[model samples]
Target chain A: MDVETLALVQQLYGAQSHYIDEGHAREWAATFTPDGEFHSPSYPAPVAGTEALTKFAADFARQDGVTRHVLTNVHVTPAAGGLTVRAYLQIVRTLPGGPPELLRQTTITDDLVRHAGTWRIRRRTVRRDDMKENR
Target chain B: MDVETLALVQQLYGAQSHYIDEGHAREWAATFTPDGEFHSPSYPAPVAGTEALTKFAADFARQDGVTRHVLTNVHVTPAAGGLTVRAYLQIVRTLPGGPPELLRQTTITDDLVRHAGTWRIRRRTVRRDDMKENR
Candidate 1:
């Protein structure tokens, strides 16, 4: 991948993590293309577009406080239409009246496109490897 | 990152998914450097080295029939000593006792290095997004 594109990906991810950690769930959802697709293997089905993405994050905001998502091991490839990326991530959630714990950890594969002079996620899928809860 | 290094990252991830789908868990572990670390946010701790990686996979061998791990949306950047990558992933696990279900989905971020002329994963972390299970 080109250096500029690669750099953009890093910046995109950094923004994502920042948005999630700051609890601006709606802004986080806006980082995607208008018709983007978000799928987590753990979720029953894919959530499409910015609206659904916003709704998904909003749901999390209800039960959790101070969530941190860390992304690393990024792999990017140039595809016919856009850039495809694979990354490993770890998420720690600290909820009210509970100790901080790892909520989920998995791999995220995403397809991103540069539109209107900015990179936006077009498709995203998450795969969970291991999980534990302190409930 | 240099083209060669970026290419290596893509190759490494492809190989990882291949090993997982093919059920060659041991071989999968060998793709890491001697002192590599594998941490899935879902998992409590990181699995270190080839030996530990192998043991972790062997544990999975007892339960599931076939598992598919798909990595995409790869982003890679050159660091001072190695390259860092982030990608999204989707995993489908099928067991003998039940229909195929989406067990876990997350993102994986990894740190990789070129050791002995081949790229090996040095560190890996996963973050789970969503999941659904069919009993």
Candidate 2:
């Protein structure tokens, strides 16, 4: 990872969390490629493409709660036509007038590609901490 | 981050966890610089130096419980003669015959320096998820 590439990925990760947490669904969706996919055990199936991703973001925003997605221990590797990145994700949630609480802990692996000089997530899969499967 | 530097950091992160989890305390301590420091709210004071780090590792092993330190969302930045790395840390624990449970969620920042062509942590500070301090 060159300095530029590492910086780009760091910015993308930060912006995604900021946009979603701040209710900027469209911006959050834009962080992904047009055909990006998001998967989690909590969802019945994978959410594919920007349109669906935007819908998911909108739904999450409608809940009108505070969410902080903290990521750490990130590792990056070069892939066929893109890069593979893995990190731990910690989601803290707070309801109206309530203290923040630990909501979810998952390990996230993302496939990202450079498009028009910017890196965008092409696929993101999240596995819970207690999952039987290994990353 | 050059590719080589990134890979070296990633390998160091992975190896540290594997060594500690496998009861290889000495190997785990070797992941740090001779003067590395580990700090957390759980500790009365920072554990400094490789010798102290080995002692800490030994204490963790004596607990006789299974622990998995999962890291993610790592960000790396160049600093004075070293790199500053930050990431999320999730610790899962399991007792004999018991299922795994979420033990701790923390944000960790590490200062790593290259010594003899190898990257080693010189300082690692951990902040709990519920802490008032912002990473």
RMSD of 2: 6.5
**Per-residue accuracy of model 1 over A7-123 as CA lDDT, tens digit each:** 677678878978757768788888889898988766788999889888887776666477777665566777778888877666777878888765555667798898779889999
Estimate, for each residue in B10-117, the C-alpha lDDT of model 2 and write its tens digit: 657845764675578988888888988998987888898889999999888776555768776778899998999988877876554445567788999999998766
Compared with the true structure, all predictions reach lDDT values of 0.73, 0.78
Candidate 1 chain B, poorest ten consecutive residues by summed lDDT: B93-102
Name the docking class for model 1: incorrect
Per-prediction TM-score: 0.53, 0.65
Stretches of candidate 2 off by over 4 Å are B1-30, B33-113, B122-135
* Model 1 chain A weakest lDDT span, ten residues long: A126-135
**Candidate 2 structure quality by residue, lDDT tens digits, A24-130:** 88899898899999988868999998899999988887875788887655656689999998776677889899988766566688999987679999999987644
DockQ of each: 0.07, 0.21
Docking class of 2: incorrect
